[model samples]
Target: MRVDTVGAVFDALADPNRRTLIGFLAQRDTATATELAAELPLTRQGIAKHLATLKEAGLVRRRRSGRETRYKLTPEPMTDAIAWMATVGGQWDDRLEALRSHLARGEH
Candidate 1:
C-alpha cells in the first residue's frame, strides 16, 4: 500500500470514536449510521461523516442495503498499521535490552 493511504488509515483511527467503530465492525461485520450512533455519543449524521472519512482513508468499505448503507472494517489497512507499530516497539525493546546490558556491566 502507498504511504499516504497507510497514514490516512492511522489518522482515521487516531480518534477514539473511529477506533470503536472499527472494532465493532470487526466483530459485527457491518453497521448502519443509526446503529453506530446508538453505540456512540455522537449523532447519526456524525457517525455517517466519520464513516465517509474512514471509507476515504481505505480503512472501511461499505455496501448499500436498500436505503441504508452499512459499513465494515477493512482489516488489511489495520494489519499494515499494526505491523508498523510492532516494528517501532521492537526497536524500543532492543534499545532497552542494550541499556540493561550496559548497566549490568557497570555493576560487575
Candidate 2:
C-alpha cells in the first residue's frame, strides 16, 4: 500500500468512535448510519462523519440500498497496514539484535 494510504488508515483508527464503528461493521455484512448510531452514543450525523473518514481511508465501503446507504468493512487497506507494521517491526528486531551483539563484543 502507499504510505499515505496507510497513514490515512492510522488516522481514521486514531479516534475511539471510529474504532467503535469499525467494530460494529465487522460484526455485520452491512449497516446504515442510523443502525450504527443506535448502537453507539453518537447521533446519526456523527456516525456518518466517522464513516466518511473510514471510506476515505479505504477501510469501509458504502452502497445505496433503496433510501439508505449501507456501509461495510473493506479490510484490504487494513491488511496492507498490518504488513507495513510487520516490516517495520522486523527491522527494529534486527537492529536490536545487532545492538545486543555489539554490546556483547564490548563495543561502544
Candidate 3:
C-alpha cells in the first residue's frame, strides 16, 4: 500500500460527515447524492461535496446512470490503509511488550 494512499484515506476519514457517508454507502452498496441527503442531515449539495472528497481519496467511485450519478464505496484503498495501521500497531505492541519486560528486570 502506498503511503500517500493511506494518508488520503486518513484525511478523508477525518471528517465525521464523510465517515457517516461511508457507512451509508457501505450498507447500501451504491446510492446517489440525493438519496444520501434524504437519509442524512445534510442537503444534496453538501452530500455531493462529501462524495467528491471521498472520490479524491480513492475511497469511493462514481458512475453515471441516466441523469443521476451513483456513488459506491471502494474498499481497496481502505484495505490498504487498514493493513498499514495493523503493521504500525503491531510494532507498537512489540515495543510496549519489550518495555514491560525490561521494567520487570529493573533495567529501566
Candidate 4:
C-alpha cells in the first residue's frame, strides 16, 4: 500500500469512536450501523458517518441485507497496520538498546 493509504488507516484508528467500532466488529463477524450506535454514545447517523470514513480507508466493509446495511472489519488493511507498527517498533527497540549500552558504559 502507499504511504498515504497507510496514513489513512492510522487516521481512521485515531478516533476513539472509530477504534471502538473496529474492536466491536473485530469481535463479531459483522454488525449493522444501528446495532453499533446503540452501544455507543453517538446516534445511528453519526455511526454511519464513521463507517463511511472507515470504508474509505479500507478498514471496514458494508453490505446490504434487505433494508439494512451491515458493516464488517477487513483484516487485510489491519494486517498492514500491524506491519507498520512492527517496523516502527524495531527502530525504537534498536535505539533503546543503543541507549542502554551507552548508559552501561557510563556506569562502569
Candidate 5:
C-alpha cells in the first residue's frame, strides 16, 4: 500500500467513534448514517462526519439509495494496511531474533 493511503487509514481509525462505525458496517452489507446513529449514542450528523472520514480514507464507500445515502465497507485499503504492517513486523521480528542470537553469544 502507498504510505499516504496507510497513513490516512491509520488517521481515520484513530477516532474511537469511527472505529465503532467500522465495526457496525462490518456486520452488515451496507447501512445509512441514520441507521448507524440509531445503534450508537451519536447523532446522525455525527455519524455522517465519521462516515465522511472513513470514505476519505478509502475504508468505506457511500451510495445514494433513493432518499438516503448508504455506506458499505470497502476494506481493500485496510487489507493493504494490514499487509504493510505484517511486512514491517516481520522485519522487526527478524532483527529481534538476530539480537537474541548475538546476546546468546555474549558479544559486547
Candidate 6:
C-alpha cells in the first residue's frame, strides 16, 4: 500500500467506533448504514460518516443495491499494515535478544 493509504488506514482505525464498525462488517460481510445504525448507539448519519471514512481508508468497499448502499470489509490493504507491524515486532525482538545476551555475558 502507499504511505498515504497506510496513514489513512491507521487514522480510520484509530476511532473506536470505526473499529467496531469494521468488526461488525467482518462478521456480516456486508451491511447498510441503517442496519448498522440500528445495532449501534450512533445515528444513521453518524454511521454513514464513519463508513465514508472507512471507504476513504480503503478498509471498506461500498456497493449500491437499488436504493440501498452497503459496505463490506476489504482485507487486502490490511495485509500490508500487518506485514509492517510484523517487521517492527521482529526488530524489537532482535534488540531485546541482543540486550539479553549482553546482560548474560556481563553476569559471567
Candidate 4 accuracy as TM-score: 0.84
Q: Which lDDT tens digits does candidate 5 get at residues 19-103?
A: 9999999999999999999999999999999999999999999999899999999989999899999999999999999999999
C-alpha-based local distance difference test score of model 1: 0.85
User: lDDT, candidate 1, residue 22?
Assistant: 80
Show pairs that collide, candidate 3: none
Cα-lDDT of candidate 3: 0.97
Better of 3 and 5 by lDDT: 3
The better-scoring model by lDDT among 1 and 3 is: 3
lDDT of 3 at 80: 99
TM-score to native of every candidate shown: 0.81, 0.98, 0.97, 0.84, 0.98, 0.91
Instruction: Give the per-residue lDDT of model 2 (tens digit) for 15-42.
Output: 9999999999999999999999999999
Worst 10 residues of 2 by lDDT: 1-10
lDDT score for residue 65 of model 5? 86
lDDT, model 1, position 97: 94
Clashes of each: 0, 0, 0, 0, 0, 0
What's the CA RMSD for each of the models?
A: 2.4, 0.6, 0.7, 2.2, 0.6, 1.8
Clash list (residue pairs), candidate 2:
none
**lDDT computed for candidate 4:** 0.90
What is the alpha-carbon lDDT of model 5 when measured against the actual structure? 0.96
lDDT by candidate, in order shown: 0.85, 0.96, 0.97, 0.90, 0.96, 0.91
Span of ten consecutive residues with least summed lDDT in model 6: 1-10
Candidate 3 lDDT by residue in tens digits, 1-108: 899999999999999999999999999978999999999999999999999999999999999999999999999999999999999999999999999999999996
Residue 31 local lDDT, model 1: 91
Question: Alpha-carbon error at 89 in model 1, in Å?
Answer: 1.1
Model 5 residue runs over 4 Å out of place are none
